[model samples]
Target: MLSSLIFLLGLPLALVAEPPTCTPLIPVTFDNATIPRLLGHWIYITGASKYGPHLAELKELKHAVFDLFPGSHEDELNVTEIMRMNETCVTRNTSKIQVFWHNSTLVHADDQVTSMAELIQSDKDLLILKHFNNNFPGLSLSARTPNVSKERLEEFKTHLHCLGFTEDEVFFTSEKDACPLPGEKTGEGSTEPQPE
Candidate 1:
């Protein structure tokens, strides 16, 4: 019981991470060269939005994980997401088509361009996307996996602040409550199945 209490006490400290510092974010174009680096599992670290409704929705979301699989077509990608919201696990699959024009990332769902974003190049493991979309207007920082560095998280928050979002508007997600993919067994770690 003492160990468990100690673990709980440390959890909040772990989340605070390092202080925010400007991480020189360089916008990178979405292309074949950058595609491979992005094709993998990404854990939603945290996001800050000026949109009120977006924050309300994010408050219900405890955790979310996304798997980006290269689609059969060159311009498309198969996206698998599992998120735990309101104490329920929700899963979604979609084919997203991305097109870049002059450094802007245009994202399409169901064959329609729904939102556009800014893709800043980080290390192979870190992905920083600055979105000004109508639906979820925010700067979101995601990682290739759950073990994200505190420095990276702080850097992302700095960028979010630079984008005009306050610290209170940020939504932080936890990996301890990860949702499972369809057909995945309970008590199993995150997995990726082969494309059919």
Candidate 2:
């Protein structure tokens, strides 16, 4: 009876002495991102998916644009995604974005849907978004302008490699007229698909 009591008294201390294990692919976020800086039109440059089931369909998306605006709440933002589907159809999807700190080092933006991207890297000219959940793990690159410098592209590739992606896995979208011209209507049936 005395030995049993001693073991019980030491159990709590043993459990408290154990250290937590950190995963290699822990999510990261940028804390300096603000609404004004993130607002504006951005062009989709390239993307890499590690294990997405819809990767093939994503590859068929030849062009995309992300237009961000301030939301009704201070911590929210409205994001409009315009994507060219199958080289012909243009689809516009809008979602509300709520930016909050997942932790001290990670910032997460969720659209309250299947789209949740972590702000891994952001700069004046480039932004890198990472999506990893039960559905899939992917990385997307966007730029302020359609024409990204070669240096930046190389840097992006390096970042992908760090994230366990090879050159063959990375797919880059075409930059030719990727976005609609000013004043052009992007509604359904506004334009017909053209053959490649």
Q: Which one wins on TM-score? A: 1
| Separate clash counts for every candidate | 0, 2
Q: Backbone clash tally for model 2? A: 2
Q: Which stretches of candidate 2 lie over 4 Å from their true place?
A: 1-33, 102-113, 177-182, 185-196
CA-only RMSD, every prediction: 10.7, 13.0
What pairs collide in candidate 2? 29-106, 29-107
Misplaced by over 4 Å in model 1 are 1-24, 101-104, 108-113, 134-137, 187-196
Would you list the C-alpha lDDT of every candidate in the order shown? 0.72, 0.66
Residue 25's lDDT within candidate 2 is 37
- Using all chains and alpha carbons, the TM-scores for the candidates as numbered come to 0.73, 0.68
lDDT of 1 by residue, 1-196 (tens): 9999999999999779754556566788656687777788899888776556556657887888888888877666778777887667766676474756556574746432354567788888887776666665677778887888887777777787766678778888987777666776767554433332
- Across 1-196, the per-residue lDDT of candidate 2 in tens digits comes to 9999999999999899764332243344435544566788888889988655437746677877878888887677776676666556454444666776554222333333355567654457776777765657678889998888887787677677777777788888886636464467666544543322
